[model samples]
Each structure stands twice: as structure tokens, then as C-alpha cells.
Target: METLLSIIFIYIFVENFVLHRFFGICPFLGVSRKMETAIGMSMAVIFVMTMATLVTWLLYTFVLIPFNLGYLQIVTFILVIASLVQLVETVLRKISPTLYQGLGIFLPLITTNCAVLAVTLLAVRLEFAFIESIVFALAASVGFSLALIIMAGIRERLEMANMPDVLQGSAVTLITAGILSIAFLGFQGMLSL
Candidate 1:
């Protein structure tokens, strides 16, 4: 329990997906112009990432490991994540049209989000146990969402603030992300579990 808690804390604040891992920067910069879009993207990512981690972990352990085909991890994980994103899209469309609309085009884009793939790969590389893998996945997703939402909020406010011509859009955003990453680094030694 302590280890799981520590992992969650580290993933969320210390080793955040965006700040630390630098995965999924495309959407982190592209889709974070609006808070609503950011929230929707974050939620979709969280759901897809958690499910993808679980499915990939099972496949890697039971199927690939049994066959000694671990070298195929990347290809196999991508296929699983793609299929899972499709399934989630279909289910959301049928069950919640509002959410489908809110998610907009980003829902499908989840297929290519490196953060999800990175989380699965990290779990495998670390050889996390079943529960630990799930916790890590969930924590990573939460961290991604936190960073996305915060960036969106800041961007929303930045629209009204004066900015230098050269550092207006992507330039300033990247700088802000760098600052946030430095801030997150402060949490590194907070917990040693």
C-alpha cells in the first residue's frame, strides 16, 4: 500500500508525464488552447491509458512471455492501444453523444498519443506487478490530465495578458512547461517510499 501510494505521488507530482517524461507533447501544445477541450482530452486519455495498460500488461505476460516473443512488445502494444481506442470511441458515441462531441477529434487521436504507449512500455520495463502496473498507469494518466488542465487554464488567462511578439504562442507555452517541470522537480525528495 505504501509503495503504491508513493508511486502515485511520484507519478502525479514528481515524474509527471508531461513535465518529466515529455510524452504526448503534440496534443499538450495543440489541443490545450481551451479548458473544455483540455478537460475532455485529459479524460479520454486517462480512460484509454488505464485500459491500454491493463490489456497490454496481460498480453505481454500471458501471450508474449509464454511464447518468448517479448521483442514484439512495441508492435503488439500499439495494436492493442489502437483497438482499444476504437472500442472506446464506439462506446462513447453510443452511450454518451455529449461526451463524444466534447471529445471531438481528439478521441481518435488518442491512438497516436505516445504517453499511453510510454506508460505501457514503462510498466513492462520496470516489471511492475499486476497491481503496481495498474497503479502506475492510473497515476501517469492523472499526471497527464493535471498538466493538460493546468496548461489550458494558464493559456486561457494568457490570452488576456500582454506578451512579447516572439514569445506569444508555442514559444511561451514551451517555456511555461519548462517552468512547470522545474516546479515539479521540487517534489522529488518529498517521499522515499
Candidate 2:
């Protein structure tokens, strides 16, 4: 339970997908302009990240380890993540047309999101147990959602602010991300595990 809590806190604040680890910056910057779209993208990301972690963990433990083919972790994990995203896209479109429409282009773009891949790799690197990996993955996705939501809120406000031309768009977003990263760095000493 303590480890699970630690994973939750770590992923949400300490090792945030965008601020600290710098994963999925493309969508983090591009898709975060509107709160609605941001929420949709975040949801898709959370689903894909969690599923990718489970499938990748299973492949690592059952397939890769058994075959002594750990070297194929990256390739196998990427393939699994890509396929999982596609499957999720199809399922969501079939079951939830509203959500499918809301997510729009971001759903397909998740295939290349580094955060999805990073969580899988980090789970293996940490050698988390099967349950622990799932917990970690879910926690990580929650963290990503938290960050995206917060960023979208900020950007929504920023859109109304009259900023200089040089500090517009990606420039301002990057600066905000940098500040958020610095804030997240404060959590580094919070947990030993």
C-alpha cells in the first residue's frame, strides 16, 4: 500500500510525464489549448497508457523472459502499444461515438506518445510486480491527466492574456512547463522508494 501510494505521488508530481520526464510534449503543447479537448486527449492517453503497461509487462515476463529475448523489449513494447492504441480507438469509436468524436485526431496520435512507452519501460526497469505495474501504470496516467488538465486550464486563461508576440504559443507553453517542472522537482526528496 505504501509503495502504491508512493507510485501515485511520484508519477503525479515527482516524475510527471510532461514536466519532469518530458514525454508527450507534442500533445502536451498542441492539444492543451482547450479544456474539453484536453480532457478527451487525457482520457485517451490514460486508457492507452494503462493498457500498454499491462500488455507490455505481460510480454516482458511471459514472452521475453521465457525466450531470453529481453533485447527485444523496445521493439515488442512499441508494437504492443501501437496495436493497443488502435484497438482502443476502434472500441471507443464503436461504444462511445461522442468520445470518439471528442478525441478526434489525438486518439490516433497516441501511438507515438512517449509517455505511453515511458511508463511501460519504467515499470520493467523498476521490476514492479504484476499488480504493482498496473497500479503504477494507472497512477502514472492519472498523473498525466492531472498535468494535462492543469496545463489546459492555464492555457485557457493565457489565451485571454495579452502576451508579447515572442512569448506566444509554444514559447509560452514551454516556459510554463519549465516552471511546472521546477515545482515538481520539490517532490524529489519526499519519498525514499
Candidate 3:
């Protein structure tokens, strides 16, 4: 139980996929201009990442290892992740057209989101149990959502702020992301326990 809690804490505050590990920056920047879109993308990511972890773990354990197919992990993981992303895209388009449109290209780009792939691959490489893999994926996705939402909120505010041309747009966004990454570094000590 304590180990699980530690995993949760470390993933969320210390080794966040977006803010710390630096995965999934494409959607992190693209869909974060609005809180609504950011939240939507985050939800999709959480669902996809969790589902991908479940499927990939099962496949690796039950099929790949048994068949000496460990060499196919990357290709297998990509197929699983891509399939999950398609499911998310279809569902989101049906239930929330506005958000579907708001997400734009970034929605499809989730198929290539390194964070999702990283979670699945990491779970196998770390030799996590089924439950542990699920927990880790959930924690990582939640951390990603937290980072995206925070960035959206800050960007929304910055839209109205007076700024020099040099610091506008992507420049400021990158700088803000750097600062956020630095702030996340403060959580490093908590992991020592």
C-alpha cells in the first residue's frame, strides 16, 4: 500500500510525463491554449494511456513472452496505442463535437504522443504487475492533465497581458514551460522518502 502511494506521489509530483520527463510536448503545447480543449485532451490522454497500458501489458505477458516475441514490443505497443487513440477520437467526436473540433490536429497526434508510448513501454521494462502498470499509467496521465490545465490557465491569462513582441506566442510559452519544469523540480526531495 505504501509502495503504491509512493508510486503515485513520485509520478504525479516528481517524474511527471509532461512537466518533468518531457514527453508529449506536442499536445501539451498545441491543445493548451484553452482550458476546455486542454481538459478534453487530458481526458482523452488519460483514457488512452490507461487502456493502452492494460492491453500492452496483457499482450506482452500472455502472448509475446510465451511465444518468444519480445523483439516485437515496439511495433506491438505502437499498434495498441494507435488503436486506442482511434477509439478515443471516435468517441470524442461523437459525444463532444465542439471539443473534437477544438482539439484539431492535436487529437490525431495523440497517436504519436511519446508519453502514452512511454508509459506502456516503461510498465513492461519496469516489470510492473498488472495493477501496478495500471496505477502508474493513471498517475502519469493525471500528472499530464494537471500540467496541461495549469499551462492553459496561465496562457489564457497571458493572452491579455502586455508583453514585448519577442516574448509573445511560442517564445513565452516555451519560457513558461521551462519555469514550470523548474518548479516541478522542487518535488525531487519528496521522492527520497
Could you give candidate 2's per-residue lDDT for residues 14-126 as a string of tens digits?
88778877888888888889998889888888888888998999989999999999999999999999888788778878998887787756778998888899899999999
Candidate 1 lDDT over residue span 76-128, tens digit each: 99999999998888898999898888775787899889999999999999989
Question: Which pairs clash in model 1?
Answer: none
With candidate 2 superimposed using the best TM-score fit, by how many Å does residue 97's alpha carbon deviate from the native? Answer: 2.1
**Candidate 2 residue spans exceeding 4 A from truth:** none
Task: Return the top candidate by TM-score.
Answer: 1
**Which candidate has the top score in lDDT?**
1
Off by over 4 Å in 1: none
TM-scores of all predicted structures = 0.95, 0.94, 0.90
Query: lDDT for model 1, on a 0 to 1 scale?
Result: 0.91
**Each prediction's RMSD to truth:** 1.2, 1.4, 2.4
Backbone clashes, each candidate: 0, 0, 0
* Rank list by TM-score: 1, 2, 3
Show the lowest summed lDDT stretch of 10 residues, model 2.
99-108
